[model samples]
Target: MQAQARGRKARRWIIFGTIAFGAVFLVVGLVLAGQSVSLLNDAERARGTVVGLEWRKDHSSSSRRNRSDDRPAAYPVVEFTPAEGTPTRFRSSTGANPPSYEVGERVEVLYHADSPEDAQINGFASLWLLPLVFGGLGLLTSGIATVVALVTRRRSRPRRSLRTTGP
Candidate 1:
C-alpha cells in the first residue's frame, strides 16, 4: 500500500511536469508565430536574385564522412534593390543540405523599409517552420499527457466485488 501510494504520487508529479514542459513549448511557439505575423504585416516586398551560395560545413552531421557524401550546406546570398535604397545583398538565415536555390534564380524578398540588410526570403520555410515545429511538439506532448492521466484515473477507480446470497 505504501509503495502504491508512492507510485501514484510520482505519477502525478510526472504528469504535472509534462504539462509544464508542454506549456513552455506552446508559449514559445505562439510568441514566434506572433512575431512572424507582425513582420509580415509591416514588411515590404521586393524581387531579389540568388547572387551566390555561402557554403558552410555541416556540423550537425557525423564527424566521420565518406569521400563522396561529404557536402556542406548551402545558404543563399540574395541581392535586391529596396524601394528607397541602393542595391542590398544579404545572406538568408535558412540553409539546406541539397541547395534549395540556384544562382541567378529570382526569389521574393521581405524587408523593413529602414533595415534592408536584415531582409528574409519570403517563403513558408523561412518564416513558419520554427513555430510549426514547436507548436506540434507541444500539442503532441500535451496529448500524451492527457491520455496517460485518463488511463491512470480509470485504473485507480475502486472495483466492487459481486456478491450472491442464496435463500
Candidate 2:
C-alpha cells in the first residue's frame, strides 16, 4: 500500500512537472514568434557588407574540457547605411566555424527605423527557428503527458460488476 501511494505521488509530480515545463516552452515560443513578426513588420530593409569577423575564445564549461577549445569562433561583422543616416556597423547574432561570410560579401539585412544599429540578417534560420522549435517541442510534450495521465487513470479505476436477476 505504501509503495502504491508512492507511485501515485510520483505520477502526480510527473504530471505537474510536465505541465510546467510545457507551459514555459509555449510561452517563450509565443513571445519569440511575436517578436519575430514585429521585427519583420517594423524593420527597414537594407543591403549590408560583411566588413569583418568578430572572434571570441570559448572558456565555458563544455569548451573547458577540450584542449583545442582555445581557438576562437567567428561571428560576422556587417556594415550598412540606413536612409537619412551614416553607415552603421553591427555584428551578427549567429556565428559559425570557418566563417559564414567573407569580408566583402553583400547580404540583405533588416534594421529598426529609429535605431539602425539594431539589425539582423533577414533569413529563416536566424529569425523563425527558435520559435518554431520551442513551440513544436512544447506541444509534443504536453500531448504525451496528457495521454499518459489519462491512460494511467483509466487503468487504475475499479471495474463495475454487473448483477442480473432471473425470474
TM-score winner = 1
Candidate 1 regions exceeding 4 Å error are 58-71, 160-167
lDDT of 2 by residue, 1-167 (tens): 99998999899899979977887898889999999899999889999999999997656777574776456778889999999679999988877677778999999989887888889988776688889999888878887888888888898889888989899
Candidate 2 clashes between residue pairs 3 or more apart in a chain or in different chains: none
lDDT of 2: 0.85
Number of the top lDDT candidate = 1
Compute each candidate's TM-score over C-alphas. Answer: 0.84, 0.83
lDDT of each: 0.90, 0.85
Per-residue lDDT of 16-96 in model 1, one digit per residue for the tens? 889778878888888889988988999999999999999987555465465576777799999999999699999998888
Show the lowest summed lDDT stretch of 10 residues, model 2. Answer: 62-71
Count of clashing residue pairs in every prediction? 0, 0
- Which residue ranges in model 2 land beyond 4 Å of their true spot? 57-59, 62-64, 67-73, 162-165
Clashing pairs in 1: none
